[model samples]
Target: MERDFYTFCTAMKTLDIGSAEGRGMSPQNYATIRLALAACYGKLSKGRVGSSLELTSEQEEHRERKGRHYCGLKEKGKRKDHERICIPGVAAAALSAVVFARMRHSSLEVLLCGLSLFDVLVLSSTLLIYPAMNACQNEPDPTNSRVCHFFWRSTLIAYPLSLIAQAGSVWTCVAITFDRFIAVFFPIKKRVWATPHTSTYIICGVAFFSVLFKLPAFFEITLNEYGQITPSSLRLDATYQLVYMTYMYLIFILLIPWTVIIVLNGIVIQKVREAYRTHKRLTQRNTRGRRDTDERKMTVMTIVMTGIFVLCNIPPAINNIIESYAPQYRDRYRHRIPLSTLLVCVNSASNILIYCWFNRQFRRSVFRLCSSAAYKRRASEYIRASKEASMSQTLKNKL
Candidate 1:
């Protein structure tokens, strides 16, 4: 009977061990649990294990959810490769081709060109051939499948590029706001502050500084065993999260850029409203009427564009902030990051629509570009028909 009881207890302990491993605990968590269990059994064998061996509620809770570090991140399911590849890659490329093809038209005006440059940067990071091919080659597992597996090494290239593009987009919109502010509030110096040459310098400077600012991220990137590429700290350490989330995301991304844009655009709007209020007093004889109209259209489109940018980008900034400070909330909100990123990509893709909606010149430009091919085809047919007719007339004269 004594031997049989011992055998039964051993079987029960074996089942317990199997259960723990089956629970999908992380290696570290599983090792700690095994160590604790061994210590408990040692005490029992030594005959000193009283009811004190019982685990506390907190210990029990920890054991129950041992493997999970954050809330929503427990399941290492599929990645978002398709959404990431399709939206920014295909959509941004299509929109950029249209904008570039119409470069001779008003669609390539100063403000629109800045936005187009941002879109081009977005396209570059997203449509890289290596990563797309990697995504295609990833095999779908019948079991243990995740959200989607990604090649983290390729992501090292993508992440910094995306950061630069986002920063450049924000700064470009801010520059446009400042240009409009000068044109509306200080008309006498508008030419000095908002000239084509000045716009080029501002754009070039923004691109240069944006790359410089985000350069650190590329150096600190790492690839995990699971083929996921991320920050060296896996976005968990307080210092790393604080630097990127509280400082970079909140201050540089959300607050400063948006604040400057809002204030400058507000002043421009006020000036425009005041000018319209005294329309009768203003001279209709200003010879720069067409130029003024075009400038105003650009201002309106830029203001709307900035507004959309702020709306789309806010969630990602907020998500990073929450993940940095409150870990539990990070788990709760991790699922939202992909959605926020999609919104930002859609913002990049939809600029041509914004341009068309607010600027009649842009609409006209697109119409002209689309119809040009048809116009050429018709002209070719007419020329061929005329040549045939002339040949027939000559043959009749010879006869």
Candidate 2:
């Protein structure tokens, strides 16, 4: 069968070329189609083709169907894993935000609150919107269903929102690191600069700029009249891919943040160690020593957060670079993409655990918050019981 198909392809290349030229088709178009046909033939004969020629419509559709089947079988476990992690991660992030907001102990809590909220946005989008979009796309007639239409439009909106949220999360980490850096290196200046108001302003600025920067992503995918999700022409531009997707993302999102976090974290860690050593030498258990210990713990927490951010994000960064420069190998590394996304989900979700583990104050606050809620519930129940007993006594006297 393969030999017969190859022979037919050869005949078309030789005979159809002349007929195609006579039928007023341009030589370039004819050549492109011929190359596509050759690639298809090679696939059947050799089990692989490396031509990179633009596939004909039928071939493209076939490839997409095959890829979908491959993913369904291979990615079932990954989808399950995503569900396991993201649901709890969203809850944890929300809990962390509430706890941090109630604390109001320092500017760091404000930054942490912002981080937690942004992480909620990230994890929620990943959990709900993207998965919904994927399920809608898998339908036979996605356009015919109102639910699919809603999710299709939601996905376009969600794409930019997710990017904005992710950017906000990244810059919030940067802000937290910078705050620690200032507290350690410029203790006298920290009072002037690292106020809650300053932190709020920084959070607002980061949010505004993140939206502005990711606004283009809104157009990256669009629903066509037929309700099929398609990449916009802007997404297909080679210059845009190279300049915006490759260079700009690498520089702004990965390189700059990574450099700032790593360098500042190292210096802050060293300063913290020096302070600890000095306190030990003094052999003082005074309020000053306690303050130093709290500061050191905060610094350690900041370092751990930044370290996790760097580690979790590294795979995605590498994957992005690979897709940008060596796209031919994308299929080979497709499994890694889901793993990278899992790492990001874990990073966003794991901050609460980090806080609980490293910060004694955070754990105490969480315990107090839970206990307070429980106390209120119990008080309400007692009041209701007392009111019912008084009503019964009144009713018995009337009888």
Candidate 3:
């Protein structure tokens, strides 16, 4: 009986009753076939034919639920990879910040310091706050746990903070590129305008505006009394999504910065190449050629950093565009989201390697910094040992 019923349902599903002509049946024939199928289903199920129809609907809903569950599992797995990658990325960014900070104060070094610091903030939030949020979410009774509440609140703040840091990092890259561009194009003007103080002011402005731009993000989500994180009413507004999220974020954060970085870096690279040729011609004048060589190295380092920025950012920018215009295709690209995020982390962490690879001065500064730290440690140990020996000898004399 069950096998016969299964066959009957399959036959009913195969029929194109809604489009009789397309199915090569007259309207009357279609109606008659539909009536016959309804009667058969009614008899087999021993209930209303509507109930039998509802069974198919329920089956469809079940399949959809299963599909959603599978997507969630895949996203969770990807998140684990994000967490693992953030650890080393954050450490590298911190080390880069320290190295840049300790280097001699210059417009380029100052901008590099700002870039590394912002990268540290970006990666730190991903490393620390996100994992805490995830752990809090998994707790059976999160509302009862004070720790969970703390993490939940921290996540709300961290979200906007991370965005601000990321924006700052992007603009700092722009600043670095722009500085190099000025040095290549207008060396005299750069000497006057592109001072370390000017770079500091630029970084401050970038950070301030970045914070102001992302302030709306703080209100996007809220932790309810039930301890469930939910989107706020503002997040549901179409105007907010269209104006703030799609247009504003897309324009200021991704489009403008990318355009500026690409254009300026292109000019800088061309100028550097031209300058390299010029320097080669002037090679016999060792003094001028050596100075030009240093300038070329600095310009090359800026180009490399901005190139990496553009390359790493492509994925996330695509994801952002898709989210704005073609969100229906989001699930198709969902698996790539994790890879995009990892690339951002790599971008943030890879600056130190670039410095080491491209800039001899930066490498020497880092080596000197490490040697100085080691010398300080040894000196402190020696001083402590000498003091201990003197104290022991005084005690022996007193005895």
Candidate 4:
């Protein structure tokens, strides 16, 4: 995550603007904070003014000074070498692809590239390879085997869909992280950095990134059909998905952004507490209330994203790390199984909620978008009636 910022900064330095240090720093810092905020909080503020902010109840958990730290994560599944390959590595790879792909120049090129790859993969797998592989497989004679057909279909669709979803999840996380990074680091010069146009560009970039990211899965995932043992998708021979996913979780998620989220949340939380303390002490800091509120909103978002990443990915990351030994008793706790699944699903689908949580403007915009035409008509009538009353003499004259 930090390297991305540094790379962005380096690119800016090449522009050779006379002394507009702010101009160069604007895009670089904005990009850094783009993912930071995207992962943690919500959408970029489109309004020209400071946005209406809503604080989350989750902010209380982060309010506690000494938050819990992760020791290790555990997984409980019987050791099947092939089963091991299917879930985690594939999941990680798809996410990594989305994260890496968005960094390229433009989303148009990205969409084209991604669409082309998606089509190619769909064509090759669906048309030629699948039918041929099914025909040649162990139960080739069993046309009555509907189970085999369904299984092959799953093998074709499920893994690819998972890869696609991961691409989205990664891009979403990246988008959140970048947004928060800008909020935290560049508080003074906010809009100068994160513009609506830039936000749209970044989001489109994320979509494209997912395409490129998922493209590689075609090479890795293949169907295994062994004598009616219920065929499955497996990563052919790769130890690690050996792509951007590993680099991303290792560098981007776990190491870099998680660290940044933690530290920034801590600082903002502490600052909020300090604002409480300083207000209590000097009694003049409530004047700092609006500024502090913005910071607190940022902190709330930071905390939420941190908690989400920690709760969702940490267990999986730990499970992956510990599975190095592929230890026994990996499946002892039935209690955590549901938690892990829920967290992962929630983590992937969470960006929309985070936006609604932090940005009242986003909420209003969404509400307005979803508002009924009837309601608008009613609102228009009310406004027109009020205007007529205020200009009662004009209404009488017009009548």
Better of 3 and 4 by lDDT: 3
Tens digit of lDDT per residue, candidate 4, span 237-347? 344433444554466435754676556556656655665566556645455666666555655654675467566767666654443334343433322443444355445
- Clashing residue pairs for model 2: none
lDDT of 1 by residue, 1-399 (tens): 434434433433333323243546676876775554443333343243453357686764553343222211222234455356545555544554565445634322655576677776675665552344334323323112232233344567787787788888888877777777776777778756666666667778888888888777676777545454435763557776677656777787778888998888787777766665655466674757666667676777777888888888888778877866777565446567766776777788777788788777667767776698689999999999999999999999999
Instruction: Please tell me which predicted candidate would have the highest TM-score against the true structure.
Output: 2
Query: What TM value does model 2 have?
Result: 0.76
In terms of lDDT, the best-performing candidate is 2
Deviation from native of the Cα of residue 73 in model 3, angstroms: 2.3
Lowest-sum lDDT 10-residue window in model 2: 69-78
Instruction: Give the Å error, residue 214, model 2.
Output: 0.6
- Evaluation by TM-score, superior candidate among 2 and 3: 2
User: lDDT-based ranking, best first?
Assistant: 2, 3, 1, 4
Q: State residue 170's C-alpha deviation in candidate 1, in Å.
A: 1.1
Model 2 segments more than 4 A misplaced = 1-78, 133-150, 376-399
